[model samples]
Target chain A: MHIPNGFLDAKTIAVTSAASAGILTVSLKKTKAYLEDKQIPLISVVAAFVFAAQMLNFPIAAGTSGHFLGAVFAAILLGPWEAFLVMTLVLSIQCFVFQDGGLTALGANIFNMGVVGVFAGFLIYFFLRRLKIKLSISAFIASWASVVMAAGITALELAISGTTPLIQSLTAMVSFHCLIGLGEGFITVAALSVIFMARPDLLKEKAFSKKITGLVAGLLITAFFAALVLSPFASSLPDGLEKVAHNLGFISKEAPSNFSVISDYQFPWVKNKSLATSIAAGVGVLAVLAVGSGFFLVLRGREDGA
Target chain B: MGHSYFDRYRQVDSFFHRLDPRAKLLWMFFFILVVVLTPAQAYTAFLLYLLAVFVLIRLAKIPLKVVFKQSLIIVAMVLMVAFFSIFKGSLEQKLLLIFNVTAKAWLCLLASILLTASTPFELLLKGAQSLRVPQVLITLLSFTYRFLFLISEEVSRMQKARKLRDFGNSRLKHLKTIGHIAGNLFVRSYERGERVYQAMLLRAFKGEINTYSDLRFMQTDVGFILITTGIMLPIFIFSILFTTQY
Candidate 1:
């Protein structure tokens, strides 16, 4: 999802960069009035929590693992503006420290994942909540809707960058996200439900009624079965962005990334691409969780002990 | 406990690190322009761009391994994109096109990495602000960066608690457990946000945000800008003049 620097044209990068900067600045400024010195510790703690959660990609199908988008989680938790800021920081650290995203393309990434993903998801969640759906069902719908929309917007960004045609990109993004949305919906509902069970007061919304626990439980059971059944087909099709790239000329135009140690995970030692990708994905999850959890515990311990 | 990543090297004194972020930003913009404008088929020009990036990376003292690792993520994506092209396109055309993309992408990544490596992210934010970037955007980014990791940690704890209780049971059970963990984390974060907002309200926040940001356009910033332009301008001119198709 992190569009690296050279994959896009200069005009694309410049315009997006400028626009992203504008949006990011507004987000930052809007957060200031809400900032209190005491909240810093809590904010930092949750940010790390989001980061770690993203790392633990649950196996969605037989061969594929999907990570959390955190947009809904961030927005619902932090408010729309604040969520954008937290996500941007995650992306920056991911790029600079961990080398996860592109530096030159940071603006585009933040725009896609941070700004578009967070805000779109938040707004959708907001509207869905207003529609008077069951709280759990509303969360499920809102969370699913947000990620799907974000994915569509990302495809649009790719098209605007001239990497692929709009329809192809849109089709590809939307199709894959259809699957991702399931996982997203389940995660959102599950997380919210447990919190509803454990500390109902923390929901902060007056509308968070307890009557919907049965509905939430029913949804979770259904999603769990759906996930279990769908696991085999997760990687059956090419993702939306990739499909669009192929249909457009960008796939042909792409150079072999200079850093490929193993081409297509087809190394002689690891003959199976599936095995190789899964291993790498698993490693990434563990790495992110370990680093994030360890770091936060240390930080929190220090603050509490002080 | 080590939370800072974007600004890790900011406080470190260096010739390159002290340049104004806006100046550094301009340099990055121009550098990316030259790299991207060069047609993917322009192998010689691509080589030149790569060489230029190599020199800059060396000068900046960014670890080769680190840059390479970062580049690898993009390379993986590019490879995935070009995977079919390898089999489908004309051999030379595919090669040239792939080379153009991979080379240009790598070079551009290098340029941006250098910018971040040399400047603190907070200062980078301030630079954007001074450049008249919208306050809304900055506010969004500020909160994103600020809380990204915190939420990540909370999710981890919930997962740990789930795992400890479940102890690597059936796959279905594990999936359900994971889902529950995610739900709890979301609820916790949502509540924390309400508290944070209340805290903010107590601070008397207006719609607009003000920061104690200080930006100085020093001689070093000017020098850095001049040197970058001196190196990049010719390449940009040449790439435009002798445009090659890949």
Candidate 2:
């Protein structure tokens, strides 16, 4: 869900950052070991295609549109590590060149979206397909589950960070994402159907062995669920910290910046705080160029650079 | 495929635009860490950071209009993200949480925007490569950047084709059309990837891509970092010191 900075505290940020970085390192090693040089472009291109695909939104309902996240789709086509790498790339680019996400919260955003979605998508598809479930059906369920799980994890992170209450946020997140998941499920199945009909051979590549993929997926899923189960306790633990927090009384986030006009308590020396944020708005348009380039390539692709 | 749309303000001459990419990258990370680690109660610190970044934005000489529009969307997205969570907390806490996140997120976005807006994509990648940020990641990121606009163009063209063909408004049909487009796009890009490899092989390409570079960490780079941290240190110190009140 692209948890912006200030949403997660230093503690949650550190944990998620370390965990996501570790997973990414292992993923990079796995990918390098598994694929040969000639075949590597497929991963890069698939990542490109996924990034492109995310931009093309389909109308879900009146006044609302949804786009594909493609984690499960990538997992089914390539493998989990490739899928993880692809999504992480997409997210990081979104964080860096585009202002779609927060740089500081990259780890948490990657953890919630990349790690959780990839593993969930890969595992569910792997197992369901083994159980002889239809490929399209397995894709539908796997993609759906991945979205829901990612949403749940995102909400939990928000709760644990003291940004939101767990239960309400969890319910809202899960319920809202349940709709989003339906879009994911349908698109995934349909996208898989494309490969099924046109280029099914892409699926058979040995991105990783079946046993190892399963094992890694199982471990990551287990760890994710463990963190999910334990995090609430950590936040609400009757330990000295929570007691100290309660004692301190809200620790009062205080708007975190001088842009605290909404609060009764304003930061000192801010005569017109609301007007000051105009100064803050000075850095977010490149994504629009990326966003606008879809139209330009038709005219510009003939002569691009070295 | 289109490099022209990559960085609109890269052509603009300014101090930030002229600094080393590695230095700017460091400034970004350091600035983000300060934003992230500052206690949420530290309003003064956030303001200070925002002002500093704004100064750089001014020095970069980029148009403020583009930056402002981008940040508005980010703040709105934050609001959308917090819609569910905001209802649970007290009025003060809820307002504080949203504003805090908006401020911190806005600050990080500006810095990143500044980084990308000021430097061309190629130089940025070259800087990251020199930083040794996993050769594979840089490679993949470079590939993604190159093909990003092309794939997007393909998808848009397909959308146009679908519209031209009178693909009816059935939601079911809509999903299938997108699936078909994606599936079609996948095969297209995949083949392009294969051809790219062949092209690379023809050029005596090894596992790594070596772009010619002339990046060096100059005195300005050092000055930028020192000045950033110089301003940052006291705000950070005073903020933590102020946190003792809570």
Candidate 3:
């Protein structure tokens, strides 16, 4: 979703960057008062959790693995404003330290994943909540809608930039995301159920049905444990992007880089795809927990003291 | 909690870091413009652009390894896209065009990374608001930056709990459990938002956000913008004058 500089025309990137910067600035001022002592640590830890969850990718079809974006989850826990801040921070670290995203496209990436994903997802949840939708059902619908909307926004941006044809890009992004959304929707619902069981105190306005929680917990617990044990055996399927790229006659468009540190994750002993992914996941979870958690505590403590 | 990294170095004593964010924004804008406007066939120009970014990377004292590493995501995307372009034309021509795209993108990435790394997120937002960016957008972005990590941490605890109890399952069942975990996360977040909003209302019950931070343009800011623009103007002119048909 992060549109690197060269991928977009000069005019497009310029206008988009300006637009994103403007929106983000206004967002900061509007929410300044809400950023209090308690909220700071809470938001940071949640962001770290999302960062960790993103590492555990489930294989789709052929060999490609698609990880959770957690956009809707962020918006759901934190407001859209807080979600955006957290995402920007996460992406900043990812780009500067880990090289996960391109620097030039940070604004665009924020626009797509951060802005569109967080706000749009929350909006859906808001509408659904207002309609007297049940918390569990609303979670499902909100999470699904957010993922789909984000994917749509991403595809639209790509089309506008002439990266791919309009319909083709939209179809590719949306279709694959739809499948991915199913996974997202279910995950969101299950997580909410757990919270309902453990911290029912958090559900002040939204009523939690214990019966549903038990049912969901029983089902999801069984499923999650199964995944942890069988994670390495998940199918290696081509994800939404790869499938679309292949079908759109752009399969051969890829070129090799002159230099890349972690290109393809090809190592000496980690020849197995699932093993490599697992290793990556292990490193990611540890990093997010150790570094992310430690960083949050330190920063929050300083801000509170100041 | 990790709010300071974006602006950590902005407070550091450096000529580039102290420049007004608006001025820095313009500098980054033009740098990207020059890079993007270059034709995909302009191989030399692309190489030159990379060299220029590399020079800035050195001058700014940013870690090269970090910048390059952060760029892997874009690199992967570029490669993925380029893979599709392999059949577009001759293998050699396709490679050159892809390289052109990749190199230009890399330079632009470095430019923005340096900007954010050097500036504080707060000041960056302040700069944007001062520039008349919409209040809603800025507010939303600020919250996003401010609370993302906290939300992530919450989700982590929930996952940890799930892991502790679900110690035994098959592959298919494991995926189902993972799926359920995601679902639960969504529900928990939705409920959390309600509490957070209530907490906010209790604090003010106001529709508008108020902030206290002073931002002013300094001579160094002007010098910084001028220097960046002046250095890159020739490259833009040359690319325009010697435009070649791809």
User: Top TM-score: which candidate number?
Assistant: 2
| Candidate 2 local lDDT, B195-214, one digit each (tens) | 98888888877767776788
Per-candidate clashes, comma-separated: 69, 0, 98
Q: How much is the lDDT of residue A162 in candidate 1? A: 38
lDDT of 3 by residue, B21-45 (tens): 8887777768876776666655666
Q: After superposition, how far is residue B100 of candidate 3 from its true place, in Å?
A: 3.1
Q: For each candidate, give the TM-score of chain B.
A: 0.87, 0.93, 0.85
Error of 1 at A277 (Å): 35
Among the numbered candidates, top lDDT falls to 2
**TM-scores of all candidate predictions against the true structure:** 0.66, 0.84, 0.61
Q: Looking at every candidate separately, what fraction of the true A–B Cα contacts under 8 Å does it contain?
A: 0.37, 0.55, 0.26
Question: What is candidate 3's lDDT per residue for A166-247, written digit by digit as tens?
Answer: 4455666778888777767776666666666766654444211222322232233223223422342232222333435545
lDDT accuracy of residue A28 in candidate 1: 50
The DockQ value obtained for model 1 is: 0.18
Best by DockQ: 2
Q: Which is the winner by TM-score between candidate 2 and candidate 3?
A: 2
Off by over 4 Å in 2: A34-36, A205-209, A213-217, A226-306, B1-3, B166-168, B243-245
Mark the 10 consecutive residues where model 3 chain A has the least summed lDDT: A253-262
DockQ of each: 0.18, 0.27, 0.13
lDDT score for residue A189 of model 2: 83
